[model samples]
Target: MQYKSQAVAKPYFIAAIGLFVGQILFGLILGAQYVLGDFLFPAIPFNVARMVHTNLLIVWLLFGFMGGAYFMIPEEAETELFSPKLALLMFWIFLVAGAATIVGYLAVPYATLAELTGNDLLETMGREFLEQPLPTKIGIVVVALVFLFNITMTVLKGKKTAIATVLLIGLWGLAVFFLFSFYNPVNVVLDKFFWWWTVHLWVEGVWELILGSFLAFVLIKTTGVDREVIEKWLYVIVTLTLITGLIGMGHHYFWIGTPEYWQWWGSIFSALEPIPFFAMTVFAFNMVNRRRREHPNRAAVLWALGVGVMAFLGAGVWGFLHTLAPVNYYTHGSQITAAHGHMSFYGAYAMLVMMMISYAMPILNGKAANSNKSQVVEMWAFWLMTIAMVFITLFLTAAGILQVWLQRVSDSPLPFMVVQEKIAIFYWAREISGVFFLIGLILYITSFFIGGDKKETA
Candidate 1:
């Protein structure tokens, strides 16, 4: 809203939410496939639905991070965007590529899609999360390079605030780490081992940098906090982030054919991974408590705080639940991993983007905040979605524990399908919670259309 170029972010935000809705829908499908076993049957198998669900989540969050960057980078740098035109162009290219890729996944067999997209030449198919064909992976790299250029040049042209700098590091690191996905060695064990280089380093390392920068930007705006103070905190926090998280990559090594020492390294370091997030919570609320201005966007403030608390609970507490090697020996690959992925991504990445959208969208719409009624509705959506996710996590955790007890720890382990049958009741409960999540999605989408009198600006 501070500059004309910021308007480009609106489309990105819209697309993110649209794809988010799609993700939740696919998620519901996967939840059904878990219990029903034939809900979609030949049309959409569990794996296909899962791929769609995860791909949509990734694409939408990328949309959000891009949107958040496009919206905030210019304002933070105190300049017009370097090239709004290029930014807009990249938007379409990325969107089209993402949507087409998804269609390819659903329309034809994955094998055919891989063959059609030239995967045989590179053999990047069949890997978890990196299952995108060669061309799609290359396209992603291209988009990332262009994006980094756009943002980096813009920062050099104007102010280089700490928030912007941290975000730039994050974005750059994201591009660098993703390249490891292409390091598909003939050795399957090595391939999966380094795959964590892309996955774990992302969520635990670079992505946290992005999350921190976004959280700092919003706190600075809403809390009327000094940039110097916030920026200094950004430095210390991200430093510790790297210190703890880079080593935390060892956690994933437990499953792969890595050395035995990783058990100790991963367990010790990864346990410390929660500190920065907890610091983030303190940082957000502290800034708000000392606010010099009472921002009219009470809903935005709510979101800021929610990200903090939820990130700590989801990423910090839940992650530490089974992070150790001994505990993971029993619980690895259970629904517990599912539980962790859902909350951590939502709290850390997904909600961070939505929080930025919440803050910036109101300003973009020519108001300090939405109508009080609109904010109330948005908050309602927040609680509904968040609380439902909590239930989902709890139910999955319960199922995972039972699974470990019945299958892994017991003297006579049940077969996989048999154990699944035993846990069908929890799946039913999870499906019910997912319904509430969908209802929240509906309410969240509906909130944007609810118009009310704008808050008075002095």
Candidate 2:
């Protein structure tokens, strides 16, 4: 809101929230399908729904990240965006490409969609998360390149700050790592080995840098903390993130036909992965305690704090739970993985984006903070969605524990389906939790429309 070009981020944020709603709705469908195998049946099979759910998550988060960058970069650099027009152009292009891809997923069969989109040319289809068609993949690269160019140029044209520098690194790394998706080697082991370059390295690696930058930016604004102190903390957090996360990639390599040495390396490094997150928790609270001013965007402040605690719990604690080779051997690809994934993603990236929106949206709409009435609603949405996710993770963790016991650790191992039947109760509980998440999402969307007297942070 400080720069005219920053107005462009409003659309990105709006579109992000829109797509987020779609993601959760599909998530509900997926959850129900788990409990009722024939819930959607031929119309929308579980696999298709699952793909939509996960893909939507990636796309929406990308939108949120882009929006956050557009909003924050200019202020950090003390300049307007290099090309607001180009930013808006790429926004439409990315949105269309994302929509078309989702339509293809829902309308045609996966194989048919792949064939139509020229999967035979490069054959990057059907990977777990990298399932976008060739053209969509290409479109992504184009959009990302253009977006990065704009932001980089903007930073170059103005004052450079630590927050902007780290953010750019994270964003550029995101683009660079995504190129691996196009590699798609024929060797299964090699393919998976490189696939983690895109998948695991993203959430656990570069994305953490992006998360830290945003956290620092918000803390500076909301807490009125000294930039020097926050930047120092940012440096420490980033260093820890890279040291821990880069080596932590070995955790995924453990079962991926990698070497035996990975067992010790992965165990040691992944165990230390929680240190950075712990630092983030301390950093958030410490800044708040030393705050020079209380921003009227109390909702945004609450979100900032939530990100620290939840990220520590989800990514730090739960991740360390099954991260070790011995524990992962039993829990790999189990519901426990799902549990960890759900919480870590929501607690870290998702909440970070939401915090950005909560902070920026009010400013974009011409206010220092939302009216107290609206902030109350937004805060309620936050807790409801967050707590709902916690329950979902807990229930899934319960299911995963039972599953590992019955299928792997038991004296008489049961078949997968039998184990699933035994765990159906937990699935039911998770599905119900998904409903609450949806309700919370609805409330979150509703917060945007609720307006009253504007409150000034000053």
Best by lDDT: 2
Lowest lDDT sum, 10 consecutive residues, model 1, at: 449-458
Instruction: Point to the candidate with the largest TM-score.
Output: 2
Relative to the true structure, candidate 1 reaches a TM of 0.98
- The residue-by-residue lDDT of candidate 1 on 21-128, one tens digit each, is 999999999999999989988999889999999989988998899989999999999998899898899999999999899999999999899889888787878888
Clashes of each: 0, 0
Residue pairs with backbone atoms closer than 3 Å in model 2 (clashes): none
Candidate 2 per-residue lDDT, tens place, 1-458, comes to: 68888988888998888899999999999998887999978889888999999999999999999999999999999999999999999999999999999999999999999989999889898999999999999999999999999999999999999999999999999999999999988899999999999998899999999999999999999999999999999999999999999998999889888899998899999999999999999999999999999799999999999999999999999999999999999999999999999999999989999999999999888889887878899999999999999999999999999999999999999999999999999999999999999899888877777775532211
TM-score to native of every candidate shown: 0.98, 0.98
lDDT of 1 at 279: 88
Models, CA RMSD each = 2.3, 2.1
lDDT of 1 at 306: 91
